[model samples]
Target: MSEEVAPHTHFQYADARHQAETALSGMWLFLASEVLFFGGLIVAWTFCRHWQPAGFDAGSRETVLWIGTVNLFLLISSSFVYSSGLAFMEAGNAKRLIQCCVATMAIGSLFLLLKFYEWHIDISEHLFPAGPFKINGADAGGARMFWSFYFVATALHAAHMIVGVGLVGWIALQARRGAFADGWLTPVEVIGLYWSFVDIVWIVLYPIIYLVGRE
Candidate 1:
């Protein structure tokens, strides 16, 4: 029950607290699973790169550094959209809240499409990690390793982008329903948490995979 709720109210204090706790606890558990998924990739990458440092370094050098940098900035800007959305939701401004979600989705779509182009260019240049590679030398194998992780991590991140678009759609629906008037903004808050978590993962990936071995 709400604190200001009347004595005759059907909802009780324990129920309200339980609901809040359950929401936060669920988010935390999901985050823990995300950590394990990415953490395992990082570990595998570390061992492989360590075993073939020269090849890994060469692969990293071949990366289009500027593109990675630009994408990082793009994603960072999208995080601001989430921040603004959270603010608008709390303030009960339905227009601004929906606007923020749409803005974030637009930016995210741009990021993913640009990423697709980047991957295409790499493939055209024979930078892929597997069979029929045209790049000369043993570094080909190493280059393949880098591309392997590149595809895996970025593809995983792109999946999150799809999920974000869905969240924005749902939020648009809620805003249309006039739900925030009741201060029922918890769903918005939870989706924001998930979106930001994905953003944070990319922030870490950007430096390690793109910038770490720069000349």
Candidate 2:
């Protein structure tokens, strides 16, 4: 009989290792579903772009390139920070883990702030698809479609970042409470997976939203 190694190990888990594996597996399954959801959106966007190449190009040009680039770096940094925290937790350094979690949360929040600012700029430039669109040409309709996808994809990605920030905050609190001091870092690892997924989604969006048609 495998001895349960952690105080928080549930009854269903035979041991700490069992619990950690199950937790990671569950997170991966959840991420798979998320991939499909986002994948569909990407596919739909690709088809729309094919149908209205000029409009999509025009819409892409309207994006604030610097802002999107900065946000991409921020999200990538947050993922790195969170991974560092996880590494610290594995090394039995709870304090450093907490610090990393806090840092990750701060970075994620900054990304959200910048994203909102970018959206504000976009709206000011009449980029919103519903109201008065800024692009004027035969490709105006396609450009409007491009803006529509931009808003939807970016907005959805931002929403995921919001959730990720909250999760990081929670993990930080847990570390402060010594939840993973005994080396049972399952929760941290699980949340790390989620945070990484959010970062990846943004990575995919950054190019599609800001770079594709620029050349």
Candidate 3:
């Protein structure tokens, strides 16, 4: 019986293990940059909220709480499912790995669907901070600012979710083709890191968008 050979390492790497470590390190660096980007947005939001607490609170109150909460759960669940897929790959269970990837994709898709619906509702209610805006108060200008931040932040996060869903689907297709059977699971691990990072971003955004100023 011949032992299975791992996937070929790129010429730039010393070996398969070296290649994997390099890939992981690259992902971490990418995510670190992402952190700074999102952190800037968060800081901007905090400053705006502090300046217009009433308006921020009103804008937050208009958000669809149930949809945001449910989407949060979906993202969290998708992350778990993707991680389970990684574990299955490590265990050499290609079938289960494929199943988990598909599940994660489905969950991510549902989250996007719900988010779109929520956006539709917000638009219809004139919550978009544009012409015919619904939020009017002593601090209507502040409220408009809040809605601007809301749209920008949530739209960015949703874009990330869209990418994550596509990646998970791709991973599923690759797993079905037995691409990771030889223990060359670097792709799976890297995608997992990306997916988890996106989920964590939403986790941070959830409270700021939904729970924080609603009281």
In candidate 1, stretches whose alpha carbon ends up further than 4 angstroms from where it belongs are: 1-14
lDDT per residue, candidate 1, 1-215, as tens digits? 34534222235435544555567678878988998899899889888988877778788887777777888888889889878987977887888888888888888888888888888888887777776765569787777787788888888888987888788778777887787766666677778788888888889898778987776
Record all residue pairs in model 1 with backbone atoms less than 3 Å apart, i.e. clashing: 1-12, 129-144
- What tens digits encode model 2's per-residue C-alpha lDDT throughout 142-185? 99999989999989998898898898999999999988878788
State the local distance difference test value for candidate 3: 0.90
Candidate 2: what lDDT?
A: 0.91
Error of 3 at 199 (Å): 0.4
For each candidate in turn, the TM-score is: 0.89, 0.96, 0.95
Could you tally the backbone clashes for each prediction?
2, 1, 0
Better structure of 2 and 3 per lDDT: 2
Candidate 1 accuracy as TM-score: 0.89
Q: What lDDT would each prediction earn against the true structure? A: 0.79, 0.91, 0.90
Model 3 clash pairs?
none
Error of 1 at 39 (Å): 0.8
Tally clashing residue pairs in candidate 2: 1
Q: Which of the numbered candidates is closest to the native, going by highest lDDT?
A: 2
